[model samples]
Target: MEKLRYERPVINKIKAGVPDKFGMSTRINTITEIEGIPVKDIIKGYGSPVFVLSESKIRDTYHEAYRAFSTRYPKIQFSWSYKTNYLDAVCKIYHSEGSWAEVVSGFEYDKAIANDVDGGKILFNGPDKSDADLIKAIENKSFIHIDHFDELYSIIRISGNLKLKAKVAIRVNMDTGIYPQWDRFGFNYENGEAWNALNRIMLSNNLELVGLHTHIGTYILSANAYGIAASKLSELAVRVHRKFNHHIKYIDMGGGFASKNTLKGAYLPGKDTCPSFDDYAESITSAIINSEIQPDHLPTLFLETGRAMIDDAAYILGTVLANKRLTSARRSTIVDIGINCHWSLMIIGH
Candidate 1:
């Protein structure tokens, strides 16, 4: 019998108005294969809804971010943010690229340690840090970014009692003309809170203030905001140097870089609209390079970007289990993957 060659008749009326945003025609960007293995072959072997991460894309994005900073600034460090995607494979890829671990929780910290990240290289940042957590951080000689006064006091007491000096930085929150400012996470820069926090840390002999940290917001499209943030951090660094004669080892502009996934109500697609690595590099590096801080004293730049680095490389491939018609006859796809499993998928579709 002759084989039947059946193809789905996909037809639609051509719409007008905005041209192709990506400058490419609207077509199915299908993934027929991966890593020399056909998609069908993979499905036959593993099953549907299996996640397929492209090692190439992961390395490429990491290189992109690394190059952006390393080329612009002399000293730069990238700490892989754990909360973004703690998959062992994903973390290993980043670690292999020489990225230190940037974890937000005790669990993530433990995971980083297990991943073979050096204790001194791991950066501990978050609002909630248990007593046991502080002890671990101090003992391991990790860089702890203090979020609140209570945490600072706790760390000081722990350091004093244990006779151990803890390397630390203050998470400073600044307004950079962005709505829904992230003031809750760190000490405010405009207000004297950040200064006050710095003073307290400096006064404590057990706490070695090592750097300045700030994460303005997430999915931030405004590159200029980074410029403003960098300027504010530089100002703090200069003030600390002038008064206390202390030079921080680094300045951390914590990750808020948008991934290639459109946010809800976003007019332009993120892949096209989101600021590129170059844009972020320009804003942040320019501010630091232009700051009054001496060139020789320019602290290392640390980026805690997680989403932008791994979102594109990781894909949740799911088979269409069922297709139903909506009330308006629009198509609704039910795949093997759900919202819980593929949180980033919803962001892309939006």
Candidate 2:
């Protein structure tokens, strides 16, 4: 007879009158393999605390998101957010999928260029752009999303000095009924600040107001918020056309679409609670289509989805270091992974 397999004995103290949250199933799910490779074998070869990314998953996710938007909107463009994962291979995958580069800093802008992404296809965003960065963006003919009046004036000066029309857009922040509103980055929409910035840009004559951009917030749970943002951006586009007789080329709804990751203190898993790609696409596209903007002159819809696109495609493998019993007889398990692992998964809840 074969020897009995060794098993670690576990004892449980049951508390009466308490029900398990996961009905009938108390065992936690275990990840044994990824992309047909055994986890143990991978760990044996690469050691513990290794990061693994699935190329196929990344491509598939990109296609899924692209299809969601492209099928709904007449014209749609996706600019891969560089800050999410600036790894060369990751960026190349997106670029191969026909995504433009959306960088938030000078380093990312350079990374996009190094990746051979056409400078014209890069969308430069963020609030800390240096004067040199502005010059490079203008020289490359990239679309620069102005975050404040100072950046706006800097771009105007750069364009005047270089004698090149800087293609630009104003980053608009609005009240989308989300808590802890992200009012720090861009011009506010409600208090007429966004319109005021647009007026200044139009008056400058050196900068071409190419688009209207807004990123409501991150891990945005409400799809209706995007609809509201789309409507507001559409209103701005219409106003710009009417006032200056110049059609805005695009409306960039900067990405904050939530990935399928559970948030702390949540009753339901994020996989079940988060809005699907179709849900977001429908909300945004429908609003723009139903807006006051003319159908024939509808601006191109641009998305810079980052977390939702790449989060699920990557996983960090780590070993459990030790297990011990606490003073209350509760089990405590320590793993090799640390806060560093959590950095990449930021905005994506565990």
TM-score of each: 0.91, 0.92
Instruction: Rate residue 280 of model 1 by lDDT.
Output: 98
Per-residue lDDT tens digits for candidate 1, residues 1-350, read 55877856656658553545454334436777666667766667666667777777889899999898889999999999999988777888889999999999999999999999999999999999999999999999999999999999999999999999999999999899998888999899998999999999999989999999999988899999999999999999999999999898899999999998766555556688999999999999999999989998999999999899988876666687887879996667788886566432211110
Clashes of each: 0, 0
Clashing pairs in 1: none
- Candidate 1: 10-residue stretch with minimal lDDT: 341-350
TM-score of 2: 0.92
Off by over 4 Å in 2: 1-5, 12-28, 341-350
User: How does candidate 1 fare on TM-score?
Assistant: 0.91
Deviation in Å, model 1, residue 33 alpha carbon: 2.2
* Model 2 clashes, total count: 0
The candidate that wins on lDDT is 2
What shift in Å separates residue 188 of candidate 2 from its native position after superposition? 0.9
